[model samples]
Target: MSANHLEQLREAVVKMNVDEAEAIAKEAMSDGIAAMIMLKEAMIPAMEAVGELFGEGEYFLPEMLGAVDAYNKCFALLEPDLKQGEFEPKGTVMLGTVESDIHDIGKKILAALLQGNGFEVIDLGTNVPSETFVKKAEEHSPQVIGLSALLSTTMSEMKKVVELFEESGIRDRFRIIVGGAPVTQQFADSIGADGYGDEAQTGVELVSRFVAAP
Candidate 1:
């Protein structure tokens, strides 16, 4: 019965049914199903499936956004219990748009997806300077640092971030991934980024890989 309940919740999230997802989350809580179990077994997997659908071109931005909303609704219901349970995140990720670039729609989506996938995200917002990235990295020590830039002129700022980390001699401490409109695998390699993600889902998968790696 618990499995059935979790499965329904998963379906609701994956199908982008926000109200149904919230209702199922409430019911699951009332039924004494641990929030952590529901998150790990149902919600995370549902979001991952949503990512897969987006990658396969079966889901578009609107569908993916709806799925994220559903997941957020369910997560909101689970957060209190999760906090009380002392739920440790899968990992921590620091995200920001590069210095001088104010485009953050992609970054915001990436943050949401990362949160839904169980990573604790520290969003540094748009027009974040390289020094701020390094400073925050020292404070938070996230496993992954994601740099985003929507404009070609600001793409060079990602290189500055990598250079700053290298200059600080903490380059090896975190996996750095670069993305945005003008970012490419070649550019990432040239700028010494550990990985490149062309989209938000890809960015989440890259972070997951970095954290799961030995």
Candidate 2:
């Protein structure tokens, strides 16, 4: 593909132009561009740039959310084609914001990052109960189960999920990963979480490593 076409796709993503982005993605695929190449060369870089801007405070939550939404639109067009091929996920992850915490922005970003890296994420949404976590794990048999808690008080809820897993005798079944603003490595260790991340990117990486490990 020409540099211009690639640049157009990147610009569409950065500008949050969902329709244009999807069009560019479909056009790229029709031109015989590889889906993984489009994802790595175009979409992931765009989202990474947005994430950098977010870290720099140049882009706020609204901008980040808009960019993610646009990227999802582009992915929606490419995903069907990719799924038709022999696509193996990097890993399977089950994610949720723990009970009593209604915050979702962090969890949503984590989901996007995981998807960008080729993990199949099953998001359980906000205010998820401990039993739900165990039940979903039983159903999906994911490699990693991620719990998010933004509130200091709700941090303990991560422990509740862990306890529930132990009670179900499936604690050894999957690695439990935890993250959020109030979460720390120490806290994760204390709560019997297998991993902890300080940011969305790190959280995705952490799960990737845990799942990839033999």
> Best-fitting candidate, measured by TM-score?
2
TM-score of each: 0.62, 0.64
Off by over 4 Å in 1: 1-87
TM-score of decoy 2? 0.64
**Candidate 2 ranges with C-alpha deviation above 4 Å:** 84-127, 139-157, 167-169, 178-190, 195-214
lDDT of 2 by residue, 92-148 (tens): 999999999987756766776677677888999999999999999999999999999
Model 1, 1-214: lDDT tens digits are 8999899999999999999989988988899998778977898789778878988999999998898889877876776665452247899999999988876656766776677678898999999999999999999999999999978999999989999999999999999999987789999999989999987789989999999992
Candidate 1 has its poorest 10 consecutive residues by lDDT at 78-87
Error of 2 at 11 (Å): 2.1
Show the colliding residue pairs in model 1.
none
